[model samples]
Structures are given as structure tokens and as C-alpha cells.
Target: MDEYPFTKLVIERNLTREEFAILMERLEKLNEQYEAQKEEGLIHFSSLLIHFAGMLTEKLEPDSTINALQREGFYPSLMNEFIRIIKQNNKG
Candidate 1:
């Protein structure tokens, strides 16, 4: 496969190339929707990314990979920002 960081990361986590491709295709669609309606679609894009990450890590022991991600300060960081953005938008 290509040498993109996200692709490599997902592959390292046990997602096959085919599964990664499928997820990429779905993410592309979500990106398009988010672009067309930026404010309204940010949550969808962020949520999809988080869900894809969870799916990619499914082969690992339950919550093991996710906990590592949190410890390493990756997904949890983004999740916090996404939640804050969602809450702020909801308030306005």
C-alpha cells in the first residue's frame, strides 16, 4: 500500500488494506458532506473518524489499544475538542 501515516497506522493496528480502503471511501464521502455544510457536519466527520479508529483497533484486546491512544494523547484529545465544539454549537 501507499506510505500515508494514517494508512500505515491503521494497518499496524490490524486492519487489512481492503478494510482501510473501504473506511477511506466512507471518510471521503463524509468529508464532502462536511465541506458542503461545515458547521452542521463537523460532528459527523469527527464522530466518523473516532468510530473508524475504534473499528481499526478491534483486533486488539478490549480497550487496550484505545487506552494506549488515550495515554499517548491522541484520540482522546481530539474527542475532547470535538465534544467541546459540539457543545458550544449546541448552545448557540
Candidate 2:
């Protein structure tokens, strides 16, 4: 399976395992803040997600990046759920 995106960043930065753990801790706190503010909406969050997708497209071959994203699962699963919902609704 392709490495997780954050794992690639950790390897590139040569972060120690301890340092990566600390970074994960910080990410968790940031996630909490994101959840808290979600109802209020966040432009930067959407921008960051779009910017990351664009960066990946620029940095990797199309197939390689897609494999990595599929391993990550969130986007693929989200699309699958959306399709399922649409199909179910159309059956009514």
C-alpha cells in the first residue's frame, strides 16, 4: 500500500519518531479546533485541502497519486457513499 501522506512528509523532513508523535499530537488538537469551528465554516480548511490536492497532482504521476489517495480512503469512501445515496433516492 502507498504510504500515508503525513508519513511521506515525516520521511522527507527526517523527523524522529518522537517528533512525528508530537506532530500527530498537534494535528489532533488542530482537528479538535476544526470540529468546533465547522458549523461556523472554514474557508482556509477548504483552501488547504484544494491546495494539497493540487500539490499532489503537480508532484506525482496521476496514477501514483490516485493510488495513494485511495489508500487514504476518505475521498473514495465519501464518493461511494454519495453514489449509494443517489442510487437509493432514485429507486423511490
Candidate 3:
């Protein structure tokens, strides 16, 4: 978007053609990344960039944020539950 100068600045850098193309593509697609940023890899990365844009837009509508947080692709909570069960078994 002409509204943001990140694309302009990156293009002005010494990046190779492939890098520049990838950068432009990413900036162009950032809005589409909002759904999966918290998970990992491509989706999470895109989601993260979109999330950063939220600051410029001035709000993070809790529904989306909480949904991203709740996706169980990775899990500390699950491991915690397993540990709790192991401790209970040890105690028993």
C-alpha cells in the first residue's frame, strides 16, 4: 500500500531481485495472514505481520487474537497436564 513506506524502503535497499520480489509479495499479502500468525512457519509469520499492522489500525479485536492463541498446534498446556498426571501417579 502506498499508505505504508516499508515497501519503498525495502526496494531502495541493496536486496537481490528475488529478495525484492519476495518482500513485495509479503507486503502485498500481509492482510491475509491475520488468521495463523501465532502457530508457526508461513501462516504464523504472515499472521504476525498482519498483527503488527493492527498497531497502525489501533485495535486487535479480542475474538481473533484469542482464537489464534487457542489453536493447539503447539502446546505447553498439554505437557503441563501430562506432568500433573505423572506427579499424581508418583504420589500414589
Q: Which pairs of residues clash in candidate 3, taking residues 3 or more apart in a chain or in different chains?
A: 37-44
The residue pairs in collision within model 2 are none
After TM-score superposition, the amount by which residue 39's alpha carbon in candidate 3 deviates from its true location, in angstroms, is 18
> How many residue pairs clash in all the candidates, one count each?
0, 0, 1
- Candidate 3 minimal-lDDT segment of 10 residues: 56-65
Model 1: colliding residue pairs: none
> TM-score rank, highest first?
1, 2, 3
Query: How far does residue 28 in candidate 3 sit from its true spot (Å)?
Result: 2.7
lDDT of 3 by residue, 9-69 (tens): 3344445667556544653454344334323443223234334335322223323322332
Superposed model 2: Cα runs more than 4 Å off: 1-3, 40-92
Winner on TM-score between 1 and 2 is 1
Worst 10 residues of 1 by lDDT: 61-70
Q: Global CA lDDT of candidate 3, please?
A: 0.38
- Candidate 1 has a TM-score of 0.41
Ordered from best to worst lDDT, the candidate numbers read 1, 2, 3
* TM-score of every candidate relative to the true structure: 0.41, 0.41, 0.27
